[model samples]
Target: MFDSLQDKMESAFKNLKGEGKLTEINVAQSIKEIRRALVAADVNYKIAKEFTDKIKDEALGSKNILKSVKPGELMVKIVMDEMTTLMGGQATGINVKGNPGVVLVAGLQGSGKTTFSGKLALFLKEKKSMKPLLVACDVYRPAAIDQLTVLAEQIGAAVYKEPENKNPVSIAQNAIAYAKGHSHDVVIVDTAGRLAIDEVMMTEIRNIKSGINPTETLFVVDSMTGQDAVNTALAFNDVIDYDGVVLTKLDGDTRGGAALSVKYTVGKPIKFASTGEKLNTLDVFHPERMAQRILGMGDIVSFVEKAQDQFDEEEAKRLEKKIKRNKFDYNDFLQQVNQIKKMGDLKSLMGMIPGMGKAIKDIDINDGAFSKVESIIYSMTEDERLKPEILNMSRKRRIAMGCGHNIHEINMFVKQFEQMRKMMTQMSKGKGMERMMQQMQQKR
Candidate 1:
């Protein structure tokens, strides 16, 4: 998640930390370092230069004006502002205005188009209270339809698919009519993807665009692809002129180039970012938060907003009751892990936390980390899962052998689980959890 870019930018600011005042020479040197850092992050050459130039001017202008703020703090503020401007200065949202409003999802192969479609449908259904129909427009691959079906089922959204229809335009049109008949408020069309930008593919998508006239046509591109992603975005924008962009796979080792310059290059805002393959990992793009993240200041506000959107009130109350009664079990622990997984992969989500990114940047955190824990938990009998305290050494060893894990690992996990349950039960019994819930409800 732009780990290298964040490291370089943080290094750039370290040179100015001990300085007494923001002089012309010191400001120039710091801005130079910032520009180099952006270049290292694969940002476009001219945009990086222009961005730092603005920061330089701002830094110098603020030096003699503000007396209360320290030089380092002022410099950080200047850089944060310039970075925000570089990445569109404001957040944009997807438009679902029309009755049975249509949102066309277009992206390159493996860009997570189908997965994002499912996530968006669930977001609309749960967060916005809109009945959404998932339309399978990828007629090229039969498995694409199946993929959407699985995701749609998991999200509890209705799906429309025509396995025999070779034309995507027809499928989408029929799906829209079906949604109207079924009283669905929104229709999300998951279109086909290409290996690369091509004329035939562009023409076909353009024809579909002309037929559907979608309320929001999103150009989904892989942020990991860097400059090529921007180029593909420009190509697609030229043909269909999409409403917004979707940067997918930001949970991967992205260089931060595409996310940095896509809005500037295509002259369209990036409305959503698909951080992972999970159906609930989609987030509305916010330039200020992203700039803060790039500068190594965590975006806790955006993180909380994402959780709030996905968190169900009734489920939270049920979990609260369970924790208060000290009835938390391995099943509840597994459910919590699944919720975190849906927010994004564990590594990426942890990286978004304030200082954890710097601490764990070198570590390889992947899906395999969850696999071991899941296997160990699955090997436990239902009785053991319900009452973890009853697991003696013999029982623990047997469970360890059943899961093919070491006894030490199983013991460590159980210890952590027990500690977590204790902390949660304490919180549930006190006002701390109530206070937090009140604050969250107020925000809503």
Candidate 2:
């Protein structure tokens, strides 16, 4: 996402490395680098300068106060704090509190408004346990209604659309009334967007807001647009005075400009961040976690939260019992893989772990790897999946033929699976750590 910015920020911190304490000379050098990094990431020069000035003052102010702390570490702390403040200091929650809360979504064309609408519907449905009604108000676009309908179906949310009704305000009003009667707890009206900010688009959105009187109005923008995204957000805010901002396509070639500059420029908290195309990839924007990620310190808290979302206590108990009995078979392994897939994209999930981002930056990790493993497992017979010990050489040959893989690949997969099963069994019995210590002692 912000790979380039992360690398540049790391370089900025390296200026303070091996120093005894923060001095004006060294702090200026590092601050200059930080300013350059922000500017390179498409942040406004004025904001960057002011941001670095605050950082410089904090660095010098804390030079002697934290003598025990390393110069590099202290500078990192200061920058992290400043960055968190630059973005919204705390996470902002959407207000879906009314009787069928109305949320009007406004943005430009191709800003991912419709897709984000779907993601938000899914998020509210699954996370908040609210029934959201997706309203298609993009009457200008010919296929917008169809796209929203498909998304609503995918997320199992109700969608309101009037294909013949070109008036978005009327459509939105009717949708809210429908939501009231249908017992929908939330109404997310996705309004029409233009190729650029124009009077027609602005007027339509404003009228829709006036008609709906939404509990929360969100301005969605494409983060990949860099500074233009911030400018667009400001424009929208000036028109409708939106309650919050939503950054979409954050997993693309984003420079981190929009996320860092939107709140500062438009005076609105970032409510949501949409990454990847998966409907489940929507996340509530947390500034502190984002700052940590930008500074090469992985967002472990978010990582744990994602895992918890997919965690199944009963399934874990069943797996633990099976592992302790040395019966963790291919089916269990496949089920575990599915659970991990539900956590999000493999690369992004791994990036959340501390020190793993840089380690896998150059590696081509994708969900396709999981597909290969799944294909092999699917090729196995039901008996083979239940009992791993029965797969001999002849069985391996048959599986290889079934999965379109050679004998060597099947053999390697089986060997790796057996090793993993054995390790899991030992771990479940609390002997894996002891065996590792013994091996280390032997090596010594």
Residue 69, model 2: Cα distance from true site in angstroms: 0.3
Superposed by TM-score, candidate 2 places the C-alpha of residue 260 at a distance from the truth, in angstroms, of: 1.2
For candidate 2, give the lDDT. Answer: 0.90
**Top-TM-score structure, candidate number:** 2
Query: How does candidate 1 score on lDDT?
Result: 0.86
Candidate 2 — which residues are off by over 4 angstroms? 431-444
Clash pairs for candidate 2: none
- Model 1 residue 441 CA deviation (Å) reads 3.9
Please give me the total number of clashing residue pairs in predicted model 1: 0
Off by over 4 Å in 1: 309-332, 368-383, 421-431
Q: Candidate 2 residues 232-302, lDDT tens each?
A: 89988889999999999987888988988888888899999888888999999999999999998999988
Cα lDDT tens digits, model 1, 1-444, are 788888887777777787888898888888888888888777889988988888888888889898778887888888888778777889987799887899999988888899889989988987799999999989886499999999999999999988888999999999999988999999999999988888889999999999999999998888988878988899889999999988888877888999888888899998887776667677888999888887778778877775676577777778888888889999988887787666666776676778877888789888677888888899999999989889999999999999999999999999998999999999988867777777887787
All candidates' TM-scores? Answer: 0.89, 0.96
